[model samples]
Target: MSVSVGIYSVPLVCEAVPQIGCGCLAKPVLARLEVHPDIAEAWLHHRGDVIAIKWLRELGVDQQVGLLRAALGGDGDSQVALVAAASSSPLLATFPNPSYWYQRETVDQLSQEEAHTIAARLVQRLSQARVPLPDGTALQCDLACALQEVLVVDEAMPIEARLARLLGVARDTFQQHLGSQALSQLDAWLTPAALLPEDAG
Candidate 1:
């Protein structure tokens, strides 16, 4: 008996496949697709977004003010970091609401001098936090002072790199120290409701 090998062809189902139509291939169509709502919203929020006071009532006035200053200082990376932290944190769910952009727009209405005043208050609040710099650190300045200097006062090259060197620690370590200490201090002032975990306290 001779065995015959048979090859079967499967038909390609265009409907089942996710395909861009020919119209989408056009330059004008592709150009129009560049406007992504999510990216646009994120950009708008990052550019001088405001933190709503009612949402941030869990934090002390100074901490809230400091965060606001940080957000409004044109530090998009910092704002994005804060939003990411809040999104990931079990205790900070209600913050950074979808309407947060409107609050930021309101902040934008403030005069330049007012923005400066807010930044000054933030610096003062950070100075009061008095988080210690790493041991044998080159900088003799207070940790908060150093943070403000690198983050707000100076437009230093490679801010994180310089900050790590000043703190005598790795970049990741410096970030962790700053974030954890700041969060810890803020957590101390959070309301009981805000402190509750997703399921239980």
Candidate 2:
């Protein structure tokens, strides 16, 4: 039987994007949606209340959504490509642990390259820090995603809903700030400079 979510008849479940407070389709849901016969197009956008059914075709043959966002966020830089590879690679598991080397003369640890890769990914996000979403209001967002998302409402919307949207935006902004700080800490700790310090000062 076909399922319906909110106003759409398509069997789609919207979930919050991790670390960025934006709406994202759950992967399993997307895997199902990808093959749905009724769906002419399915776009897994980083924002929007529902997945953009028309956006899928824009992804083209190389339609891995993560790579698309990585390219966009990094401005098509090679460094972003490297970081994207590491994010998907299981090889990251093999990287040595991070710890103090003062106690031991020699310690096994991640290479500088590996550390940089990790550091880059730690700060990586699926979308820009903030996006304006027209609140039709793009599915229900009780807890919201972890990033900064601004909700724009039609003038006709009720004041209560508008106020609610404003509050949601405020929460998202705060959450984004905390996420940024945490990622920065991770970046500083795992970057090449931290791992292979020439000055050690």
Give the clashing pairs for model 2: 20-146, 20-147, 21-145, 21-146, 21-147, 49-138
Candidate 2 Cα deviation (angstroms), residue 152: 30
Off by over 4 Å in 2: 1-25, 54-201
Task: Give the per-residue lDDT digits (tens) of candidate 1, residues 1-201.
Answer: 222111111111111111211110111211221232211211122122222222312444345344433333423333322333433343224334433222222222222222233234333433455645443232222333443333222222442354344333222233454556555553342322221122432
* Global CA lDDT computed for model 1: 0.29
Clash pairs detected, candidate 1: 50-104
**Estimated TM-score for each candidate:** 0.19, 0.20
